[model samples]
Target: MQINGSVALVSGANRGIGRSFVEALLARGAAKVYAGARQPERLADLVDAGKGRLVPLKLDITQPADIAAAAGRCRDVTLLVNNAGINLQAGLIAAHDLAAARAEMETNYFGPLAMCRAFAPILQGNGGGAVINMLSILARVNLPMYGSLSASKAAALSLTQGVRAELATHGTLVVAVMPGAVDTEMERNFPPPKLAPAEAARAALDAVEQGAEEVYPGDMASGMSQGLAADAKAVEKDLAKYLPA
Candidate 1:
Protein backbone atom coordinates (compact mmCIF):
# COMPACT_ATOMS: atom_id res chain seq x y z
CA MET A 1 0.00 0.00 0.00
CA GLN A 2 1.11 3.56 -0.59
CA ILE A 3 2.76 4.81 2.60
CA ASN A 4 2.14 8.46 1.84
CA GLY A 5 -0.52 9.87 4.13
CA SER A 6 -0.86 6.54 5.90
CA VAL A 7 -0.72 6.18 9.66
CA ALA A 8 1.49 3.49 11.18
CA LEU A 9 2.13 2.03 14.64
CA VAL A 10 5.45 0.35 15.37
CA SER A 11 6.25 -1.49 18.57
CA GLY A 12 9.78 -1.32 20.10
CA ALA A 13 10.27 1.95 18.28
CA ASN A 14 12.71 3.33 20.82
CA ARG A 15 15.74 1.69 19.26
CA GLY A 16 17.32 -0.91 16.95
CA ILE A 17 15.33 -2.36 14.03
CA GLY A 18 12.14 -0.85 15.39
CA ARG A 19 13.67 2.62 15.32
CA SER A 20 14.81 2.02 11.77
CA PHE A 21 11.30 1.04 10.71
CA VAL A 22 9.86 4.15 12.35
CA GLU A 23 12.32 6.36 10.49
CA ALA A 24 11.83 4.54 7.21
CA LEU A 25 8.05 4.78 7.41
CA LEU A 26 8.21 8.51 8.06
CA ALA A 27 10.71 8.95 5.24
CA ARG A 28 8.19 7.24 2.98
CA GLY A 29 5.73 9.96 3.91
CA ALA A 30 3.55 8.34 6.51
CA ALA A 31 1.17 11.00 7.79
CA LYS A 32 1.60 9.79 11.34
CA VAL A 33 3.50 7.12 13.28
CA TYR A 34 2.65 5.91 16.76
CA ALA A 35 6.03 4.95 18.14
CA GLY A 36 5.36 2.37 20.83
CA ALA A 37 7.84 1.45 23.54
CA ARG A 38 7.81 0.42 27.18
CA GLN A 39 9.24 3.84 27.90
CA PRO A 40 7.63 6.24 25.45
CA GLU A 41 9.98 9.06 26.39
CA ARG A 42 12.83 7.07 24.88
CA LEU A 43 11.46 7.97 21.47
CA ALA A 44 12.34 11.65 21.76
CA ASP A 45 14.41 11.59 18.58
CA LEU A 46 11.57 10.14 16.59
CA VAL A 47 9.18 12.71 18.04
CA ASP A 48 11.54 15.44 16.97
CA ALA A 49 11.80 14.05 13.46
CA GLY A 50 8.07 13.71 13.07
CA LYS A 51 7.53 17.32 14.16
CA GLY A 52 4.25 16.39 15.83
CA ARG A 53 3.52 13.54 13.47
CA LEU A 54 4.96 10.97 15.86
CA VAL A 55 2.90 10.06 18.87
CA PRO A 56 4.59 8.03 21.58
CA LEU A 57 2.54 5.24 23.12
CA LYS A 58 3.49 3.13 26.14
CA LEU A 59 3.35 -0.52 25.16
CA ASP A 60 4.41 -3.71 26.83
CA ILE A 61 3.11 -6.46 24.60
CA THR A 62 3.09 -8.94 27.47
CA GLN A 63 0.40 -6.86 29.13
CA PRO A 64 -3.12 -7.03 27.72
CA ALA A 65 -3.92 -3.60 29.12
CA ASP A 66 -1.01 -2.06 27.25
CA ILE A 67 -2.14 -3.75 24.06
CA ALA A 68 -5.68 -2.46 24.49
CA ALA A 69 -4.47 1.04 25.32
CA ALA A 70 -2.24 1.10 22.27
CA ALA A 71 -5.09 -0.10 20.10
CA GLY A 72 -7.28 2.69 21.41
CA ARG A 73 -4.57 5.27 21.09
CA CYS A 74 -3.64 4.43 17.49
CA ARG A 75 -7.06 3.51 16.22
CA ASP A 76 -6.45 5.24 12.93
CA VAL A 77 -3.32 3.30 12.11
CA THR A 78 -3.20 1.61 8.73
CA LEU A 79 0.07 -0.21 9.27
CA LEU A 80 1.21 -2.24 12.25
CA VAL A 81 4.83 -3.30 12.63
CA ASN A 82 5.44 -5.94 15.30
CA ASN A 83 9.11 -5.31 15.87
CA ALA A 84 9.58 -5.80 19.58
CA GLY A 85 11.26 -9.00 20.74
CA ILE A 86 13.46 -10.63 23.37
CA ASN A 87 16.21 -13.24 23.27
CA LEU A 88 16.15 -15.54 26.23
CA GLN A 89 19.22 -17.11 27.79
CA ALA A 90 18.59 -20.69 26.85
CA GLY A 91 19.78 -23.43 24.55
CA LEU A 92 18.31 -26.47 22.81
CA ILE A 93 15.57 -28.57 24.33
CA ALA A 94 18.17 -30.70 26.10
CA ALA A 95 19.78 -27.68 27.80
CA HIS A 96 16.80 -25.37 27.95
CA ASP A 97 15.64 -23.20 30.79
CA LEU A 98 11.89 -23.66 30.63
CA ALA A 99 11.33 -20.22 32.10
CA ALA A 100 13.56 -18.51 29.58
CA ALA A 101 11.97 -20.45 26.76
CA ARG A 102 8.57 -19.30 27.92
CA ALA A 103 9.81 -15.74 28.19
CA GLU A 104 10.89 -15.87 24.57
CA MET A 105 7.46 -17.11 23.59
CA GLU A 106 5.79 -14.39 25.62
CA THR A 107 7.75 -11.62 23.95
CA ASN A 108 8.68 -12.91 20.51
CA TYR A 109 5.65 -15.04 19.70
CA PHE A 110 2.67 -14.10 21.86
CA GLY A 111 3.55 -10.42 21.82
CA PRO A 112 3.12 -10.12 18.06
CA LEU A 113 0.16 -12.45 18.15
CA ALA A 114 -1.58 -10.17 20.62
CA MET A 115 -0.59 -7.09 18.69
CA CYS A 116 -2.03 -8.53 15.48
CA ARG A 117 -5.25 -9.48 17.21
CA ALA A 118 -5.62 -6.02 18.69
CA PHE A 119 -4.79 -4.22 15.45
CA ALA A 120 -6.81 -6.29 12.97
CA PRO A 121 -10.10 -4.58 13.63
CA ILE A 122 -8.45 -1.21 13.82
CA LEU A 123 -6.96 -1.69 10.36
CA GLN A 124 -10.14 -3.10 8.94
CA GLY A 125 -12.10 -0.20 10.34
CA ASN A 126 -9.61 2.13 8.69
CA GLY A 127 -10.41 0.46 5.36
CA GLY A 128 -7.90 -2.40 5.64
CA GLY A 129 -4.13 -2.12 5.86
CA ALA A 130 -0.99 -4.14 6.56
CA VAL A 131 0.80 -5.88 9.42
CA ILE A 132 4.52 -6.54 9.40
CA ASN A 133 6.10 -8.98 11.86
CA MET A 134 9.84 -8.99 12.23
CA LEU A 135 11.29 -12.50 12.27
CA SER A 136 14.78 -13.96 12.02
CA ILE A 137 16.73 -16.51 9.99
CA LEU A 138 16.78 -18.51 13.21
CA ALA A 139 13.09 -19.09 12.67
CA ARG A 140 14.00 -21.84 10.22
CA VAL A 141 17.25 -23.14 11.74
CA ASN A 142 17.71 -23.78 15.42
CA LEU A 143 21.07 -23.08 17.01
CA PRO A 144 22.07 -23.52 20.65
CA MET A 145 22.29 -19.82 21.49
CA TYR A 146 19.21 -19.10 19.42
CA GLY A 147 17.20 -22.08 20.60
CA SER A 148 14.48 -20.15 22.37
CA LEU A 149 14.42 -17.45 19.75
CA SER A 150 14.19 -20.06 17.01
CA ALA A 151 11.19 -21.72 18.54
CA SER A 152 9.48 -18.42 19.24
CA LYS A 153 10.11 -17.13 15.75
CA ALA A 154 8.94 -20.39 14.28
CA ALA A 155 5.65 -19.97 16.14
CA ALA A 156 5.41 -16.34 15.07
CA LEU A 157 6.05 -17.36 11.49
CA SER A 158 3.13 -19.75 11.68
CA LEU A 159 1.00 -16.98 13.15
CA THR A 160 2.08 -14.69 10.35
CA GLN A 161 0.89 -17.21 7.78
CA GLY A 162 -2.38 -17.85 9.55
CA VAL A 163 -3.06 -14.15 10.07
CA ARG A 164 -2.26 -13.42 6.45
CA ALA A 165 -4.86 -15.88 5.28
CA GLU A 166 -7.47 -14.82 7.81
CA LEU A 167 -6.96 -11.09 7.31
CA ALA A 168 -6.94 -11.19 3.52
CA THR A 169 -10.73 -11.26 3.31
CA HIS A 170 -10.67 -7.91 5.03
CA GLY A 171 -7.99 -6.60 2.66
CA THR A 172 -5.34 -6.58 5.33
CA LEU A 173 -1.85 -7.70 4.36
CA VAL A 174 0.17 -9.69 6.85
CA VAL A 175 3.84 -10.22 6.16
CA ALA A 176 6.73 -11.89 7.96
CA VAL A 177 10.16 -10.43 7.48
CA MET A 178 13.02 -12.86 8.28
CA PRO A 179 16.26 -11.02 8.19
CA GLY A 180 19.75 -12.32 9.07
CA ALA A 181 22.07 -10.71 11.59
CA VAL A 182 21.49 -6.98 11.52
CA ASP A 183 23.91 -4.36 12.81
CA THR A 184 21.97 -3.46 15.92
CA GLU A 185 22.34 -3.35 19.68
CA MET A 186 20.64 -6.72 19.94
CA GLU A 187 23.63 -8.25 18.23
CA ARG A 188 26.22 -6.25 20.17
CA ASN A 189 27.51 -9.20 22.14
CA PHE A 190 27.52 -11.74 19.36
CA PRO A 191 28.89 -9.88 16.39
CA PRO A 192 28.23 -11.30 12.96
CA PRO A 193 28.66 -9.75 9.54
CA LYS A 194 25.33 -8.19 8.68
CA LEU A 195 23.49 -5.80 6.48
CA ALA A 196 23.11 -2.25 7.72
CA PRO A 197 19.80 -1.39 9.37
CA ALA A 198 19.05 1.20 6.67
CA GLU A 199 19.55 -1.35 3.92
CA ALA A 200 17.40 -3.94 5.67
CA ALA A 201 14.69 -1.33 6.27
CA ARG A 202 14.71 -0.36 2.62
CA ALA A 203 14.35 -3.97 1.52
CA ALA A 204 11.56 -4.53 4.00
CA LEU A 205 9.59 -1.56 2.69
CA ASP A 206 10.14 -2.70 -0.86
CA ALA A 207 8.94 -6.20 0.06
CA VAL A 208 5.73 -4.76 1.49
CA GLU A 209 5.14 -2.70 -1.63
CA GLN A 210 5.79 -5.69 -3.89
CA GLY A 211 3.38 -7.89 -1.94
CA ALA A 212 5.95 -10.37 -0.72
CA GLU A 213 4.56 -12.80 1.85
CA GLU A 214 7.97 -13.41 3.43
CA VAL A 215 10.96 -11.14 3.17
CA TYR A 216 14.59 -12.21 3.67
CA PRO A 217 16.22 -8.79 3.88
CA GLY A 218 19.92 -9.42 3.47
CA ASP A 219 22.22 -11.43 1.21
CA MET A 220 23.38 -13.47 4.17
CA ALA A 221 19.85 -14.51 5.05
CA SER A 222 19.02 -15.18 1.42
CA GLY A 223 22.08 -17.32 0.92
CA MET A 224 21.58 -19.32 4.09
CA SER A 225 17.96 -19.96 3.20
CA GLN A 226 18.93 -21.27 -0.20
CA GLY A 227 21.47 -23.63 1.33
CA LEU A 228 19.11 -24.83 4.01
CA ALA A 229 16.36 -25.44 1.50
CA ALA A 230 18.67 -27.65 -0.47
CA ASP A 231 19.77 -29.69 2.51
CA ALA A 232 18.04 -29.16 5.81
CA LYS A 233 19.66 -31.95 7.85
CA ALA A 234 23.06 -31.24 6.36
CA VAL A 235 22.79 -27.56 7.14
CA GLU A 236 21.77 -28.34 10.69
CA LYS A 237 24.70 -30.68 11.04
CA ASP A 238 27.08 -28.03 9.74
CA LEU A 239 25.58 -25.42 12.07
CA ALA A 240 26.28 -27.77 14.96
CA LYS A 241 29.96 -27.26 14.37
CA TYR A 242 29.66 -23.72 15.68
CA LEU A 243 27.86 -24.70 18.88
CA PRO A 244 29.54 -25.63 22.14
CA ALA A 245 30.03 -29.33 22.87
Candidate 2:
Protein backbone atom coordinates (compact mmCIF):
# COMPACT_ATOMS: atom_id res chain seq x y z
CA MET A 1 0.00 0.00 0.00
CA GLN A 2 1.10 3.56 -0.71
CA ILE A 3 2.16 5.68 2.26
CA ASN A 4 0.48 8.86 1.03
CA GLY A 5 -2.69 8.14 2.98
CA SER A 6 -1.66 5.27 5.21
CA VAL A 7 -1.65 5.27 8.98
CA ALA A 8 1.71 4.01 10.26
CA LEU A 9 2.93 2.71 13.62
CA VAL A 10 6.68 2.68 14.23
CA SER A 11 8.07 1.08 17.38
CA GLY A 12 11.12 2.48 19.24
CA ALA A 13 10.41 5.86 17.73
CA ASN A 14 12.50 7.67 20.34
CA ARG A 15 15.74 7.33 18.39
CA GLY A 16 17.83 5.66 15.72
CA ILE A 17 16.26 4.24 12.54
CA GLY A 18 12.84 4.19 14.16
CA ARG A 19 12.97 7.97 14.49
CA SER A 20 13.98 8.23 10.86
CA PHE A 21 11.08 6.00 9.87
CA VAL A 22 8.59 8.35 11.52
CA GLU A 23 10.06 11.34 9.72
CA ALA A 24 10.15 9.52 6.40
CA LEU A 25 6.58 8.35 6.78
CA LEU A 26 5.39 11.87 7.48
CA ALA A 27 7.35 13.22 4.52
CA ARG A 28 5.75 10.56 2.34
CA GLY A 29 2.37 12.02 3.36
CA ALA A 30 1.21 9.34 5.75
CA ALA A 31 -2.19 10.32 7.14
CA LYS A 32 -1.04 9.62 10.70
CA VAL A 33 1.83 7.97 12.56
CA TYR A 34 1.81 6.40 15.99
CA ALA A 35 5.25 6.86 17.46
CA GLY A 36 5.60 4.05 19.99
CA ALA A 37 8.29 4.12 22.70
CA ARG A 38 8.70 2.58 26.09
CA GLN A 39 9.25 6.06 27.42
CA PRO A 40 6.77 8.21 25.57
CA GLU A 41 8.12 11.27 27.38
CA ARG A 42 11.31 10.90 25.42
CA LEU A 43 9.27 11.51 22.26
CA ALA A 44 8.30 15.05 23.20
CA ASP A 45 10.41 16.51 20.43
CA LEU A 46 9.03 14.17 17.81
CA VAL A 47 5.48 14.74 18.96
CA ASP A 48 6.05 18.48 18.74
CA ALA A 49 7.59 18.26 15.28
CA GLY A 50 4.79 16.01 14.05
CA LYS A 51 2.29 18.82 14.76
CA GLY A 52 -1.00 16.97 14.80
CA ARG A 53 -0.32 13.92 12.74
CA LEU A 54 2.01 12.16 15.19
CA VAL A 55 0.45 10.35 18.09
CA PRO A 56 2.70 9.34 20.96
CA LEU A 57 1.90 5.78 22.00
CA LYS A 58 3.33 4.44 25.26
CA LEU A 59 4.18 1.08 23.86
CA ASP A 60 6.74 -1.42 25.02
CA ILE A 61 6.52 -4.22 22.45
CA THR A 62 7.89 -6.58 25.12
CA GLN A 63 4.90 -5.93 27.31
CA PRO A 64 1.55 -7.52 26.59
CA ALA A 65 -0.48 -4.69 28.09
CA ASP A 66 1.35 -2.13 26.06
CA ILE A 67 0.85 -4.08 22.86
CA ALA A 68 -2.82 -4.54 23.62
CA ALA A 69 -3.30 -0.86 24.34
CA ALA A 70 -1.55 0.18 21.17
CA ALA A 71 -3.59 -2.22 19.10
CA GLY A 72 -6.84 -1.07 20.60
CA ARG A 73 -6.08 2.60 20.18
CA CYS A 74 -4.30 2.55 16.85
CA ARG A 75 -6.91 0.50 15.06
CA ASP A 76 -6.56 2.78 12.04
CA VAL A 77 -2.94 1.82 11.48
CA THR A 78 -2.33 0.58 7.94
CA LEU A 79 1.42 0.17 8.23
CA LEU A 80 3.50 -1.45 11.01
CA VAL A 81 7.20 -0.67 11.24
CA ASN A 82 8.86 -3.17 13.57
CA ASN A 83 12.02 -1.15 14.05
CA ALA A 84 12.55 -1.61 17.77
CA GLY A 85 15.53 -3.84 18.61
CA ILE A 86 18.66 -4.03 20.73
CA ASN A 87 22.15 -5.32 20.00
CA LEU A 88 23.92 -5.97 23.26
CA GLN A 89 27.15 -6.75 21.42
CA ALA A 90 27.37 -10.09 23.15
CA GLY A 91 28.95 -13.32 21.94
CA LEU A 92 26.77 -16.42 22.43
CA ILE A 93 29.18 -18.23 24.79
CA ALA A 94 32.15 -15.93 25.03
CA ALA A 95 30.17 -13.38 26.98
CA HIS A 96 30.55 -15.59 30.11
CA ASP A 97 26.78 -15.38 30.61
CA LEU A 98 23.57 -15.76 28.61
CA ALA A 99 21.91 -12.58 29.91
CA ALA A 100 22.82 -10.46 26.91
CA ALA A 101 21.84 -13.17 24.49
CA ARG A 102 18.42 -13.58 26.08
CA ALA A 103 17.88 -9.81 26.20
CA GLU A 104 18.69 -9.46 22.53
CA MET A 105 16.22 -12.20 21.63
CA GLU A 106 13.48 -10.67 23.74
CA THR A 107 13.76 -7.24 22.17
CA ASN A 108 14.88 -8.12 18.68
CA TYR A 109 12.89 -11.30 18.14
CA PHE A 110 9.98 -11.70 20.52
CA GLY A 111 9.12 -8.02 20.60
CA PRO A 112 8.54 -7.79 16.88
CA LEU A 113 6.71 -11.08 16.87
CA ALA A 114 4.41 -9.86 19.62
CA MET A 115 3.69 -6.63 17.79
CA CYS A 116 2.98 -8.44 14.55
CA ARG A 117 0.56 -10.77 16.26
CA ALA A 118 -1.28 -7.96 18.05
CA PHE A 119 -1.62 -5.87 14.91
CA ALA A 120 -2.37 -8.58 12.37
CA PRO A 121 -6.11 -8.28 12.81
CA ILE A 122 -5.93 -4.51 12.74
CA LEU A 123 -3.97 -4.53 9.51
CA GLN A 124 -6.41 -7.02 8.04
CA GLY A 125 -9.31 -4.80 9.03
CA ASN A 126 -7.59 -1.82 7.49
CA GLY A 127 -7.70 -3.38 4.04
CA GLY A 128 -4.60 -5.49 4.16
CA GLY A 129 -2.01 -2.96 5.24
CA ALA A 130 1.75 -3.38 5.09
CA VAL A 131 4.51 -4.47 7.54
CA ILE A 132 8.13 -3.34 7.32
CA ASN A 133 10.62 -5.24 9.46
CA MET A 134 13.99 -3.54 9.94
CA LEU A 135 16.57 -6.26 9.71
CA SER A 136 20.29 -6.48 8.97
CA ILE A 137 22.62 -8.43 6.71
CA LEU A 138 23.53 -10.23 9.92
CA ALA A 139 20.20 -11.95 9.49
CA ARG A 140 21.65 -13.96 6.65
CA VAL A 141 25.16 -14.61 7.99
CA ASN A 142 26.48 -14.55 11.53
CA LEU A 143 29.09 -12.04 12.61
CA PRO A 144 30.51 -13.70 15.70
CA MET A 145 31.78 -10.30 16.78
CA TYR A 146 28.14 -9.66 17.54
CA GLY A 147 27.07 -13.27 17.63
CA SER A 148 24.00 -12.99 19.82
CA LEU A 149 22.68 -10.03 17.87
CA SER A 150 23.22 -11.94 14.63
CA ALA A 151 21.35 -14.90 16.03
CA SER A 152 18.41 -12.74 17.11
CA LYS A 153 18.18 -11.04 13.74
CA ALA A 154 18.42 -14.38 12.01
CA ALA A 155 15.42 -15.50 14.00
CA ALA A 156 13.66 -12.28 13.09
CA LEU A 157 14.31 -12.87 9.41
CA SER A 158 12.66 -16.26 9.70
CA LEU A 159 9.72 -14.65 11.47
CA THR A 160 9.47 -12.11 8.70
CA GLN A 161 9.32 -14.83 6.08
CA GLY A 162 6.71 -16.76 8.00
CA VAL A 163 4.59 -13.67 8.54
CA ARG A 164 4.85 -12.84 4.84
CA ALA A 165 3.51 -16.23 3.83
CA GLU A 166 0.70 -16.12 6.38
CA LEU A 167 -0.40 -12.63 5.39
CA ALA A 168 -0.15 -13.15 1.64
CA THR A 169 -3.80 -14.04 1.35
CA HIS A 170 -4.72 -10.79 3.03
CA GLY A 171 -2.73 -8.78 0.52
CA THR A 172 -0.61 -7.42 3.36
CA LEU A 173 2.80 -6.50 2.02
CA VAL A 174 5.30 -7.88 4.54
CA VAL A 175 8.72 -6.40 3.80
CA ALA A 176 12.10 -7.45 5.17
CA VAL A 177 14.36 -4.41 5.06
CA MET A 178 17.97 -5.50 5.30
CA PRO A 179 20.66 -2.87 5.47
CA GLY A 180 24.41 -2.96 6.10
CA ALA A 181 25.78 -1.68 9.40
CA VAL A 182 23.75 1.45 10.07
CA ASP A 183 25.32 4.66 11.38
CA THR A 184 23.31 4.69 14.57
CA GLU A 185 24.41 4.79 18.18
CA MET A 186 23.54 1.12 18.22
CA GLU A 187 26.52 0.61 15.93
CA ARG A 188 28.84 3.27 17.28
CA ASN A 189 31.69 0.81 17.74
CA PHE A 190 31.12 -0.73 14.31
CA PRO A 191 33.39 0.10 11.40
CA PRO A 192 32.91 2.86 8.87
CA PRO A 193 30.97 2.69 5.55
CA LYS A 194 27.80 2.29 7.55
CA LEU A 195 24.53 3.31 5.93
CA ALA A 196 22.78 6.31 7.44
CA PRO A 197 19.57 5.58 9.30
CA ALA A 198 17.65 8.09 7.21
CA GLU A 199 18.89 6.54 3.99
CA ALA A 200 17.80 3.11 5.15
CA ALA A 201 14.37 4.45 6.09
CA ARG A 202 13.92 6.12 2.71
CA ALA A 203 14.94 2.98 0.88
CA ALA A 204 12.49 0.91 2.94
CA LEU A 205 9.62 3.32 2.33
CA ASP A 206 10.45 3.24 -1.35
CA ALA A 207 10.31 -0.54 -1.27
CA VAL A 208 6.87 -0.35 0.32
CA GLU A 209 5.62 1.87 -2.47
CA GLN A 210 7.15 -0.48 -5.02
CA GLY A 211 5.53 -3.52 -3.39
CA ALA A 212 8.81 -5.29 -2.75
CA GLU A 213 8.93 -8.24 -0.35
CA GLU A 214 12.65 -8.12 0.50
CA VAL A 215 15.01 -5.17 0.06
CA TYR A 216 18.70 -4.51 0.63
CA PRO A 217 19.03 -0.78 1.29
CA GLY A 218 22.78 -0.32 1.07
CA ASP A 219 25.58 -1.39 -1.26
CA MET A 220 27.30 -3.54 1.37
CA ALA A 221 24.09 -5.32 2.30
CA SER A 222 23.15 -5.83 -1.35
CA GLY A 223 26.58 -7.19 -2.16
CA MET A 224 26.60 -9.48 0.86
CA SER A 225 23.16 -10.80 -0.02
CA GLN A 226 24.33 -11.64 -3.54
CA GLY A 227 27.43 -13.31 -2.13
CA LEU A 228 25.24 -15.51 0.05
CA ALA A 229 23.15 -16.41 -2.97
CA ALA A 230 26.20 -17.48 -4.98
CA ASP A 231 28.23 -19.23 -2.24
CA ALA A 232 26.68 -19.62 1.17
CA LYS A 233 29.65 -21.43 2.66
CA ALA A 234 32.10 -18.82 1.46
CA VAL A 235 30.02 -16.00 2.94
CA GLU A 236 29.60 -17.90 6.17
CA LYS A 237 33.33 -18.47 6.53
CA ASP A 238 34.10 -14.84 5.68
CA LEU A 239 31.68 -13.59 8.33
CA ALA A 240 33.04 -15.97 10.94
CA LYS A 241 36.32 -13.98 10.91
CA TYR A 242 34.54 -11.12 12.65
CA LEU A 243 34.47 -13.14 15.87
CA PRO A 244 35.93 -11.08 18.69
CA ALA A 245 39.04 -12.02 20.63
Candidate with maximal TM-score: 2
Candidate 1: stretches off by over 4 Å: 93-96
Model 1 lDDT per residue over 1-245, tens place: 87888898989999988899889998999999999999998988789998888999999999999999888777799989999998754676655347878899999999999999999999999988889899988888876667777889999999999999999999998878888888888877666687788777777777778778788888878987998889989878876665523
Q: What is the C-alpha RMSD of each candidate to the true structure, in Å?
A: 1.5, 0.9
Task: Give each model's whole-structure lDDT.
Answer: 0.86, 0.92
Cand. 1 Cα-lDDT: 0.86
Model 2's C-alpha root-mean-square deviation from the true structure amounts to 0.9
Every model's TM-score: 0.95, 0.98
**lDDT measured at residue 152 in model 1 versus the true structure, 0 to 100:** 93
lDDT of 2 by residue, 14-77 (tens): 9999999999998889999999999999999888888899999999888999999898899999
In angstroms, the error of model 2 at 22 is: 0.6
